[model samples]
Target: SPPTPPAPSEPEPPAPPAPAEPAEQGQPFAPSPAGSAADLGDAPSQFPNAVPPTQDFDDDPQGFEQPAPSRKSGLRARPVIALALVLALLAGLVGGVVGFVFANRVFTNNGVNPSVSLGSPPPPGSSARPADSVAGIAAKVLPTVVSLDVAGPSQSDTGSGFIIRSDGYILTNNHVIEAAASQGSITVGFNDGSKATATLVGRDPAYDLAVVKVDKKDLPTLALGNSDDIVVGDSVLAVGSPLGLTGTVTTGIVSALNRPVTTGDSSTQDTSFINAIQTDAAINPGNSGGPLVNSAGAAIGINSAIATLSQGSSGSGSIGVGFAIPINQARRTAEEIIQTGKSTKPVIGVTLDIRYTGPGAKIADNAINGAAPVTSGGAADKAGIKAGDIVLSVNGRTVNTADELIVAIRSYKPGDTVTLKVQRGGSTQDIKVTLASESTTK
Candidate 1:
């Protein structure tokens, strides 16, 4: 369903969910004359979305407050009566409790303790370390980042990419260069104003990853970090040319993990499922293929898509919902592509029932579209995964949809062992399935 077509004509990755807001005419995420960062580059490689909300969109609506349950989460709590209470208790040998209570009430007002001197305090603004902020990480990674200008025969687009190997090997979204892979020119522009022509080495549409190479051997490259180790709430910096703004930097936190995100419309969409790392980072047009680095300046994800309300003439902007392909998946795909002219995907050996509206991914009882419900002697078939079985999870990761099941399986490399939670015959069981290589399975 994916990665097999390395041709230039492969359809673009799923278009980010554009806001339903009616603009003038909805357009794909390409460098437009209306947005910022026009002069930086011409090829924009990112997604489209709506303007971000001024307030926290995910903030839970405050319910009606209950009496007597006030908390000063936003205030600084100063313990001013502690010393007085302790001193009173020590002074009184027997009625110390009575004396301490009297002192506490007199010194405290509405739980607002007076600011008491607690030895010498650090100077104002002494706690913040400049090196620990997003700017610090950006400074370390921006040099390794780059912008790509692709001039296709039919259309031109601007996108972003980053240095992965000092020998001029670059990593980026396959969608970024898909339109220009065969009939166009791709120019790699560095932060220092130097530009070089880059040629595609290999690409995998299944993972939306590609590797391109320049002539230089001394390009700055970013170190790939372990995506499996990243946690929610981790501070991150997204560096790229959002809307063609070169060297643009945005700060955000990991909003979710293992997010099952599939972009594209019903007509032309990649069959591969992307298990993305969700972030609130403002990824916009031309930010695709950019690096999502952590506090330590390690690249953990590639900014790929942004969720929008709908598409229109106003075009898609950032809605604070962005998805990044995990570095773990990207790294493996890129490496395989660099080594070989193509990449292999992991398959579970079953044709999922996409139309089934059931809770979990349902395997079709009958063959549909020439693909059998279960491949004979394939991984799933070997593990006794039948046609009616409903897959509930993968290695403890709950999967409620066929998209999720596919994404979860793809997260693991072929030849790796994984346990699938399946429902069969009114009972549930954990079946161990060793993933089969897409090439072998097919």
Candidate 2:
């Protein structure tokens, strides 16, 4: 009690509070400096477990202390980082230059882009044709084919032909050179790019054939084959200058035989009757007079006409139906023209009754013209073909009209025997007659 009286003399100014403990291990805290009461009044509280206002706390809930980086160490690291950045930039620059150079070398050729590649060519003779192949036959036949150009006073036309004699005797259609026969010119063009003026040796409008001669020797000629040997389905090639296309070659098969074809204008006497060899070859207007060859490259027919669906100046192209003059008849007519400058037509020596509209070709009962219905001592009269008789057939081929009978009779050469089925009043009889030759004139 006496010591108490000594009184808490100057209660040692509440010993400054201890510093707060760090929230985590290794964290340190600093205490505020001693100050007067007034000075410390505005200052943070110095109580234990309380933080000083001057001190900063970590944002982490569990306070973690990060060491302050040294200024000297930061200065030293700045140069190292700058050096690394500079090296990276230099490396990028060098890589870009190398890539540009490599790309240039790979895509450029003397500063020009390369052309498209098609690979190497095929080996020679890999597509060689046999001797009997179409190519081979064309090679052998093309040289013999000739193009005919005719120039008339009012018209000019072109056709095709083939060599028939080595002395430059060429065979063509009468219609081809007909315009030139009177007062025109005819020029023959060879496959070898050579040309010659041709003179008409002979022409037969009835047979639609002609022969032209050129002052040429050793000319290649085509071999004439027997048309009788060629039946239906036989392979044939038609060579001509179609549409003025020189050396044109087309192939097909024999479609029919003994087709009666009457061509030319009926108003004129130039009308021709032909026992045609029908084929599916592509024949056009310019193809007239060209050779229709067999598989052996032998001339079997002469391409003469094409059947068209329409007719006019606009004209028409091929529809695969073509007619050719049988080479047998052509041969006979050609021979006669060559030997005597004329040809002949076989006749039965009877005038047809054009008014008779019966089922068969009829003979006139009386003389319509000044001539007799049946010529005396001629083929028909000698064979007992009476006037007013109807010819039912010729050589086993049916004849329904006067034209059919004429065409059938003309199909045979003169002096050839033919059996004609004739219908009289009430009897039908087969009469054998030897055809007589009648000369044809221009």
Candidate 3:
């Protein structure tokens, strides 16, 4: 089991008061040249004659004056005004004819305007996207994707998940809901704006997967695809609530596959080893447990961790590199958790020497802890694997580190037989082993 998170610390004491400073002086205000009447009333009595008195222009000797026209002069101007009106009417008639002729030439059937009728409006439904298009996939997948708001004793978080079963079973990353696992709350927000309280069904920390259930039934679910069918450079879309932006989708290609990714605190059971499908899709803090779907809109992986340039509690954004748990593995773990309250992890029953700096993972010559280095009658022991044997590969895949070998084995279920390329002394040979199951309960 993972260790309980530490309690939040008390806040620091307030800083001491600063030394006193002299009071600030106000700046002098300058009055406008044309001051208001209120300003004149408030002015000092000694400045009563400051403004010059108003002068009347009616008796000014320099003013230019004109007399009104006489009645006989006005009668003479009327004939001239009538002749000017008659000329203006004839000019207006000529201008109207010219304007009409110009308009008739420009607006006729031979004009550019008539040649530019809107391109026959596209056939109805022509705007619809192809079924395999990104938009089409998003349209089909968004309703199945959901946002998770988890409130715990010390902190709160938001992540993403998707409906897996019509009866309200949801699949999400274990870490997304781990904070609220003990005496907290989980709220599921749907794309349709509906929300419901959820109860934890089960979780496997080893796989970093958890299943939760709501009270509702007949909910739409996303279709699951075979992760094994995924190849490099295949177009994929990551659908999730990244940074709490619900129903967000990003596009990318499968940059790599079968990447061994180990995360979480190694000292506790919270550690997760994944045979991850690497992608360049933007996966961020809140995108955990969201689906990485193919062009067909079928989910092939679960968006999990992201590679960042910085480390520690200070968060960072995606750097074009992201990893997702293969849906094949997630499907198995999810099915097991739904059936039972827990899931199992595949183990080879041999302790690896972590300190060995070699080409391949080397088994410890002796036990590191209290347990034996090799379990008697276990899969590794039964396959004739001895202590200090370096494992070069699982099946045909090369494993350079202990984590690589562990994740490669974890990709399979219990009782599956896999061939291991092991080197003992100066010789290397192939050994077949049937993997064993260990409960992930603790």
Instruction: Find the candidate with the highest lDDT and give its number.
Output: 3
Compared with the true structure, what per-residue lDDT tens digits does model 1 show for residues 246-298?
99999999999999877644365444468999999899999999999999999
Q: Which lDDT tens digits does candidate 3 get at residues 1-442?
A: 8998899888888887554343233211223123334233343344555443243223346542222124566667899999999999999999999999877876875565554567687667755777888888889999999999999999898999999999999999998998888769999999999999999998888989999999999999999999999899999999899889998999999999999998888887589999999999989989998999999999999999998785564668888999999999989999998998789988989988889887889999998886677888899999999999999999999989998989999999999999999999999999999999999853
The regions of model 2 sitting more than 4 angstroms off are 1-115, 126-128, 311-315, 355-358, 369-371
Give the per-residue lDDT of model 2 (tens digit) for 282-335: 999889999999989999999999888855546587899999999998888888
Question: Best candidate per TM-score, number?
Answer: 2
Cα TM-score of candidate 1: 0.69
Candidate 1 stretches greater than 4 Å from native: 1-129, 264-269, 311-315, 439-442
Q: What are the lDDT scores of the predictions, listed in order?
A: 0.82, 0.86, 0.87
After TM-score superposition, the amount by which residue 241's alpha carbon in candidate 2 deviates from its true location, in angstroms, is 0.8
Lowest lDDT 10-mer window, candidate 2? Answer: 30-39
Candidate 1 local Cα displacement, residue 272, angstroms: 4.0
